[model samples]
Target: GDDAKAAQRVVRQWLAKKGITAPHLVMENGSGLSRAERVSAREMAGMLQAAWRSPYSAEFISSMPIAGTDGTMRKRLKTTAMRGEAHIKTGTLNTVRAIAGYSRDINGNTWAVVAILNDKAPFGASSVLDQVLLDLYRQPKLPETASVL
Candidate 1:
């Protein structure tokens, strides 16, 4: 569909506005239907992090799949500490797997998470991503230093 092309142009414009020159950015289909679509984990992470700080952050976060509650993440990460702690959007294809969103660490730190894998077997990829969320939740909390605000 031409929506992909339009979306790609808009993304490029946004990147320019942010003064980010991502030479490797490639978007062939907005729905990720085409294998030609390409993106790096780093770029996706940057996008998610920016969304976290944007004025529409709440809207963006609310659109994601809440872990163990609803959407694609509903059935995943259930019965774990990561349940309801992660708002992730997952993507899968015959040869591609991707998950990107935000999660809170044990110390209440919001982390932007993104993982992209091009593998023949993507069945177990979600578990790997969920484990990361669980690990973040179980990580030891560092002593809080005095804030000089």
Candidate 2:
């Protein structure tokens, strides 16, 4: 947590030095575990838009999940239509289970998706979230941000 805090401060300073005006950006924790934290859906969308505008978009996209290989998405999406096709980050807490990622449709349209599930116990957490992702991949496009979780 300290590392993330320090990094956030340092980044904000660097961005300021570069003449970029940004928000306070209260990332309670880089991993989003703090209970009092608030993240606007609009800001998340803007981040995705910014990523698209970055010069290294190709590198960013390619570095994403390869389905069965690395990162939090490694165990999942083994042999499905999403194999080596999506990169998502999963978060879990007492009352939280969330995932956000990018998926490119067959038509080559890339969509960024975020899904969150809360106010529930861990009784069947893993299976429940797995089903969420399966449904999303099964559907046409990664539905809107609030569609599948």
Which candidate ranks first by TM-score, i.e. highest?
Answer: 1
Off by over 4 Å in 2: 1-26, 29-31, 122-149
Candidate 2, 37-123: lDDT as tens digits: 655544554455556567987787666665567877788777667666666667778887766666644444455665666766766
Q: Point out the worst 10-residue segment of candidate 1 by lDDT.
A: 140-149
TM-score of 1: 0.84
Per-model clash counts, in order, read 0, 1
- Candidate 1 stretches greater than 4 Å from native: 1-7, 140-149
After superposition of all CA atoms, the RMSD between model 1 and the true structure is 4.5
Candidate 2, overall lDDT? 0.62
For candidate 1, write residues 25-73 as lDDT tens digits: 7777656677777778877777776677789999999999999999999
Top candidate (lDDT): 1
- Model 1: pairs clashing at backbone N, Cα or C within 3 Å: none
Give the root-mean-square deviation of each candidate in angstroms.
4.5, 5.4
